[model samples]
Target: MVIGDGILTPCISDSIVWISAAILVGLFMVQRFGAGKVGYTFAPILCIWFLFISGIGVYNFIKYDPTVLKALNPKYIIDYFKRNSLDAWISLGGVILATTGAEALFADLGHFSVWSIQISMCCVVYPSITIAYIGQASFLRKNNDLVGDTFYKSIPGPVYWPMFVVSVLAAIIASQSLISDFLHNPTIPLSRVLPLCEIVHTSPKYAGQVYVPEVNYILMLACLGVTLGFRTTAKIGNAFGIAVVFVMSITSCLLVLIMIMVWKSSLLYIIGYVVVIGFVELIYLSSVLYKFKEGGYLPLAFATILMAIMLLWNYVYKRKYYYELNNKISPERLKEIATNEKICRIPGLAMFYSELVQGIPPIFEHYVKNVPAMHSVLIFVSKKSLPISSIPVEERFLFRRIDTDGVNVYRCVARYGYRDARSEEEPFEKILIERLKDFIREDLAVNEGERLEAVAREIEVLDQACFSGVVYLIGESEVVAKQGSNLVKKIVIDQAYNFMKKNLRQSNMMLDIPHARMLKVGMIYEL
Candidate 1:
């Protein structure tokens, strides 16, 4: 593991961090174009780099002491422990740092296809890294005094400058990939503080590449902070090793479960696998934990805080959803309100946004109670994101007319795939009106002359309403814990969740609704 520390270390400095800081800023700035484009730009450079190291490794292996090959024997691992014991055990923290950002490569599999990842890792990465390690070991053994800067000193002279540039680029690319892994202090504040919107489809071809501008900046700042704080590869390697082992151990535990529960392996085989892999991970875990005061506690703190936030968010989310579910206005109640002549019918078109898919939201009741009148053409628009990529534009609007007494009330489900960008403000209303007109034509097509006349009249009303104006009505509610709630629940809802909600993307901003024509109906949710 120690042998894989550097393909070519560039004498990363403690005193001068601005160079690294600049590289990080530049790396994160390009994230708006997404990983696919970034990958395309950097892939060739990385391939060349791997090949260079691999070639250097092979050259050094033949030229230097061939006796170093004996170190490949498994006995050396056991012998090293016997010789140094506690010191060797402590060094496992640094040794494990060789695999830094490797787990991130696996986590970032969503940015690429399965076959591409497999081919690249197997054909290029693993082989190149192994050869580079062998070469470094052979050269270091031959020139024992150059052990301090193993990778750089071992490199052939003509390739040294190129290696330095490539190494820095490699580090940048690596940290770019590591962006998805959020650290605690920065992550919590950024997420709860910044009003950043998540841009899902940064690349038209890649659905999984998410670009949050605020997150990118926060991560950049965090990288700069970490770089400025630790100031060297050796010190930061403490955190790096912990992060790597945490991922590896979790992955192994999941794999073990899969092998036992899903694969239904034999008892003896399960025991063997657990004993071997578990022991190795525990060994590294303990070593990494020893450096907790140095840096290892970073990930641990991040996990604890993130987990708490998630749990609190989820708890409130479920309760609030159910509250909306149970309190949704039934069809009969909708008809009653629509038929009520005292509830004055206004002229323009009103689109009320809601979360409930089936029935009218409780907020509708709140709106009608406070406000005496509603628009002539009412639509309960619930924007839905399906678990897929890119819903077709023509099929995006699903118009279902509600049987509200003599009123043109509709339940318009604006469906979008997860990767689909929300439609523009003007087009959204225009498309819905057009789709509603088409829906009326289709429904009345199956009816008689009187129905056809009604259809024409309805379309005329819709057109007249559109020409008058379209107003987006949404309930902007303050979510809070009920009066009788416990202190913890109150804190979760009133403090943390509310803080996040306040800073999160606004509904009008999210839906691209025009602020001039938007009416915010405020209410309170005591969950």
Candidate 2:
């Protein structure tokens, strides 16, 4: 709107809305290609933007009242606060916009080195922003009538068109950065927070650079809605101010917790941190909350709805996990079932995927009780994610032989880190087979005398049998409301959890197992 109004007449400014919408849609559509391809293109443009703003700021500051620099003095801030009090505090909400993108520094830490980001900010961004704001203030002091369009009006006549172009480009780039952060960061797994969608990782070098088509379109549609509904920058800025202050307050609170728990800081340090950061953020948060009736309510409304969904998901998941832990069969029970001659044995290898590491899942027992048959080679597989970024390939899988019967029963645990890519390029069956082969070779090398011979013989038979085929088994379990449960539990488990389970990506698809060889055993839990 500023760019269109600045360069063109009022007639052309109306068309700028549709133009902005089209550009936003185009930016989101190109996200599937990944950030690595597009991130570099923005760097030079951003540099130019900073330099231009700083240069204009310096020029304007020198031409107008150089005395305006006196506003930087601490006494002026103190005097203004003392004089206006509540009004001054309320205006601080507008002041937060000056530091809008500062949070991105911490967010982009995953993409760039700390030292590099610090150097860039210290040398270019901070100085540029400081001078640019001072220059805007100086320009406004002289030309009070042009306060609404100060940025465009301050530009020199000769370079107006070029400056307008740069402003529009910079605005689009800024919007793109925020949209990408919303889609990728907060570290929430798409399967848990959203419905099933293909999440494409664009950069192999940076696991954080992901593109979700569903999220991208959703964001685009939302941007269009806000743009059309508000039809003015002032209303949008009001909502934007609420969102910025809310995020800042939340970030400060999280940092305080991290300092106490992760850094193990002293009480003195905690008090100082809270007094410095918390005081400022709380003031801003309170100011924004006061404006809740005037467009500020939009962000709080959205956040409340989202928080309810996440809380319900957490509750249901915990209940289901507790139920599974209590119902899991003991290892002795599994051995007894394995040794039973009454159970007919089938010919192929069967891998049952379950959540428990130490015991047999109820789903497996249910499958066997109904069919009255077990596979020649039984393997229970569990894939667990650790808190770290990536696990070493050598330490990825752990295998242990369970029962000594002619039909071999084994347990395999595959460990992965949170950021580790579970590439679908290699099938799960193939990886498991290779890991098992490695385990056999290692066991043969380590064991002495009679044990070595036994291991070799077992490996030979296992190799031949595995060559036949493999079957992947997983449970399709659902949680139902148990008798005497409260209303909240019933609503959370029977309704919310069931709805999410039905909509989310299935377990077999997530594991990348082939549909033809996969068996999904349906089961119900009265929890």
Q: Top TM-score: which candidate number?
A: 1
The regions of model 1 sitting more than 4 angstroms off are: 1-15, 180-196, 257-272, 422-426
Kindly give the stretch of ten consecutive residues in candidate 2 with the minimal lDDT sum: 2-11
Model 2 compared with the native: what TM-score? Answer: 0.88
Over 1-527, each residue of candidate 1 has an lDDT whose tens digit, in order, gives: 11011111111222257787676667667877776778788888888889889999998999996678798899999999999999999999888766665655545566777898788788989899889989999998878898778988988999999998887678666655556333111313222333335554566565566677765675566566777776776666666677678878887888889998899999999899989999999999999989988866666665666577667776777787788898889999999998887899989899999877899878888888998798889999998766567777789888888998668999989998757664454377777788888888887665587888988899999988888889999888788889999998888889988897787676677777778998999888888
TM-score of 1: 0.90
User: CA shift at 402, candidate 2, in angstroms?
Assistant: 1.5
Query: Which residue pairs in candidate 2 have backbone atoms (N, alpha carbon, C) closer than 3 angstroms, thus clashing?
Result: none
After TM-score superposition, what is the CA distance of residue 304 in candidate 2 from its true location, in Å?
1.4
How high is the lDDT of residue 113 in model 2?
A: 70
- The candidate scoring highest on lDDT is 1
Q: How accurate is candidate 1 locally (lDDT)?
A: 0.75
Q: Estimate every model's Cα lDDT from 0 to 1.
A: 0.75, 0.74
